[model samples]
Structures are given as structure tokens and as C-alpha cells.
Target: MDYDDAYANVPHIPDGESYPPRWAAEAAAFREARATDRNDLGVSYGDTPRQAYDLFRPETAPKGTLVFVHGGYWLRFDRSYWSHLATGALARGWSVAMPSYDLCPDVRIAGITTQVARAIQNIAESEPGPLTLAGHSAGGHLVSRMIQPGLLPIDVTDRITTITPISPVSDLRPLLHTAMNAQFQLTEDTATAESPALMTERLDIPTHIWVGADERPVFLDQARWQADAWSCPLRIDKGRHHFDIIDALKDPVSPLMRDILG
Candidate 1:
């Protein structure tokens, strides 16, 4: 595969940079409409400042909790950027938690994974119910790693019923070939260790992989590869791209949300 073509995103979606600012605006609007008091914002998962999470609830006791990990290729972005994504799941009586972990170069990818696991466990300590995780891009990889056999404690692992990885690069090995490796600093061993695709053992918890029809071939291949390896189903979200495909989570009635909810 052409590594450049596979990883190229902003070039594929002409208005790519605009999406982040728009998403930030939407998140702000979503928070204003909801009660900041109802949200258990900035609950610490780890010792560091970035290792905290925000948990937002519904009117009554939630059926379950759904946590969303925001994507910035393990380089940037955080919880504050994704509050709007809780819109659909919250409307369905689910509490949504968004956790921001320390970015790479500051903390390695594996370190970020551990921090996120800690974040989820921290939430579970109080919530104590079935949990679901959904993430986009690098965030997707982090969420799936929770089921990577020995990565998490059994208690936390048992509570996670489903994992939805949207447009995630399951295999990090390919990424090592790219110029961005300067920032990632992945060795062959760490790449394999952190790659969800290499977790070849099929998991007991159901895994739903989402890929956008309009996304670059490499993004589609990444999700498809993992599905085939695990013998699970893959959902190609029609007419969606890497950035906007996430909007499905913001809409309660969309097919994207329905597929994820199932």
C-alpha cells in the first residue's frame, strides 16, 4: 500500500482543518444546553492533569455508561473537544464519559493506554455498571486495547460489554514507516505490543468496527483487517468521512447511532 496515500487525511477531505473548530463549537453549544452541574467534570483518573475524565448523566439513573475517547492520532485533542458526541447516547438514557489522556511525545502511546484504562477503572469504581467504549482514530485504538488480554484488571474488563472503534488504525506497524514516526517514536516491539490488530485472539466482548465509506482506503483497510482477523462484522457507514462520520453519535435517530447502540 502507498503509505502516504493510506495515512493522508486532510488532503482527502479538503475542509479537514475546519472540522476541529466546528466540533469544538458544537461541544460548547451542547454543554451550554445541558447542566454543567449534572456533569462530574474533571474527575481525576491518574495523578496528572490531562489524565482526567468528564462524566455526563441523563435525567434519571442511566441504563449504562458509555465512554468516548477523542482522536488526534495520539498527538492532540481531548475530552473538551468531544462533549457533543454524547448527544445521541445521552438521549437514550445512557451516561456518557469523555476522558482526555496525555498526548504522545509527552507520554508514549502505551503510557496513554495505561492512563485511559485507569480512567475507565476510576469511573467504574463509582458507576459500577455495564460499560461501552467508542473512539475515533487513535482514540479508537486506545479503547480497543482495554480488551487486549492482560492490559486491564479483570474487574474493569468484565464491566466493558462492547467496544466501538471508529476509523481506527488497528495495525500501528504501518505507521512506523511514515514521517510522523518522529513524534510517535515507536519501536518494532512497541508497535506490535500496542497494535490491536496483533491481539489476534477473539474477544468475549462484542467488538463493532465502524469505517466510513468516504474515508481513505487505508482507514477502511485498517478496520476491515481487524474484523476479518476476529471474524466479526464490519459496518461501512455510507457517505461518511473520517471527520464527519463521528456526527452519527451526535444524532439519536441516525443509522450510525443505531448500529453502534446495537
Candidate 2:
């Protein structure tokens, strides 16, 4: 029942420290491999340095666009670490845009939410197209929130074909017990406002919830909560843990990839 221990992931994963370097290396290689197709290395969405995104476009007209957000509990990682995640979407004929945001401690979770909204709007304005938004971990909660009744303008929501938040944290109340709250600084009011699981209003747009079977039970429950509350479909990938669950996003033929591209 210790929320801190229960939610902690890196401690349980022996090689957790290696993940950052691996992500950075893979993202660099992906950029190099797709040098020609890659543009907008650091497109500014806001005035800050981190408020930027990278756009990877296919040579021919893209079927649509996929805006990807990376999750590090709103405190770690950036768009650079997740560039390779665009691979599957790109190969499947979708332009992919990955965005970086100002982290927690520097800003509250509530502020980060707006930053994402701004980032998505900036991308939407720059390259308007049918949009499919996806995020992981904290990113999942973000993409999910973007579709809430008043979060994004109706025009933008109308253009979003689907939203896929992998291993999303639908509810944020539990995090108050975890050490992460130091950076997140959540209160009952803010948690209620941000918890998609607890929200009664449902988005009209289609949504697909995904979580790896091996992830902590909290994640599975969160994913189910969003699916049930929103009347959407959920997919569980057996044997995939929290970190590796995202691997499918880079595989064009993976069921997860097809789900996003569709």
C-alpha cells in the first residue's frame, strides 16, 4: 500500500540507468538515417528553449500526422530521447512530430499540461492534417486530457482521428503519496482537475487505450479506467513491461503501430 514504492519503476528495473543513453543514441541514429526526411529539428512552440518540436515528414504527401509525446513523469526526458519512436508512424505514411516540454519543479503539472496543449496547437497550425496523438506514461495522461471538453478548440478536436495513450496515468490522486509529488506538487483540487479517470465528460473522438501486461497493476487499471470511462477499446500486450512496451511504437507492422496509423 506504499504508493511511493508501488509506483516507482526504475528501482524495479535493474538496467534502468541504461535507458537514457540508449534512447539518446537511438534517437541520434534515427535522425541521421532519415536526415533528408527530417526537418524542423527545433520548431518553437513557446518562447522557452524546451518548448520546441521536431518534424519528420515522408517524401511524398503523408497520409496524416502523428504527434508523439514522451513520458518521464513530467520531470525527465525530452523529445530528443524519443525521436526514434516516430519510425513506425513515419514508415506507415504519417508525418510524425515529437515535442519537448518544460519539466516539473521548473513548472507544475498543471503548467506542463498547458505546455502540451500549446505544443499540439503549434504543430496543428504549422502542418494541418488528420491528427493522431499518442503519449506514454505521463504523456498518456496528457494526450488524454487534450481531448477533454474544453481543453482543445472544437476545430482541432474535429480533425483528430484518434488518440492513443500507452500505459497512461488516468488518475493522479495516488501520486500524492509518492515521492514524485515533490516535483509534481499536486493537491486534491489540481488532481481532480487533471485526472481523466475521474472526469465524467467523454470525448467524442475515437480513442484506443494500450498497456503492457507486465506493467504495474496501477498502469493496467489506469488504462482500463480510461477505456471504460470513455467507452473506448483497450489492448494489453503480454510480456511487455513499462519501458519495453513502447518498443512497438517503432515497429511499422506491429499491431500497436497499425493502431496509431489507422
The top-ranked prediction according to lDDT is 2
lDDT of 2 by residue, 1-262 (tens): 9888788777766697788899899999988887664567998999899999999997778888899989999989999898888888878888999999999999988888899999888888878679999999999999998987877878777889989999999999999889889988999999988998887886788889899898888888889988888888999999888898999988999989878876
Candidate 1 lDDT over 1-262, as tens digits, reads: 6776669798789788898898889888888888777788889888889989989998888888898998988988889889989989988888999999998788899999999888888888888578888889998898888887776778877888889899988999998988777889999999998888888654588888998999998889999988887676789989999998898898878776665665
Global local distance difference test of model 2: 0.88
- Supply the global lDDT for candidate 1: 0.86
Model 2: weakest 10-residue lDDT segment is: 31-40
What would the C-alpha RMSD of candidate 2 be, to one decimal place?
1.2
Give the Cα-based TM-score of candidate 1 against the true structure.
0.96
Q: After superposition, how far is residue 21 of candidate 2 from its true place, in Å?
A: 1.1
lDDT scores for all predictions?
0.86, 0.88
Off by over 4 Å in 2: none
- Residue 181's lDDT within candidate 2 is 92
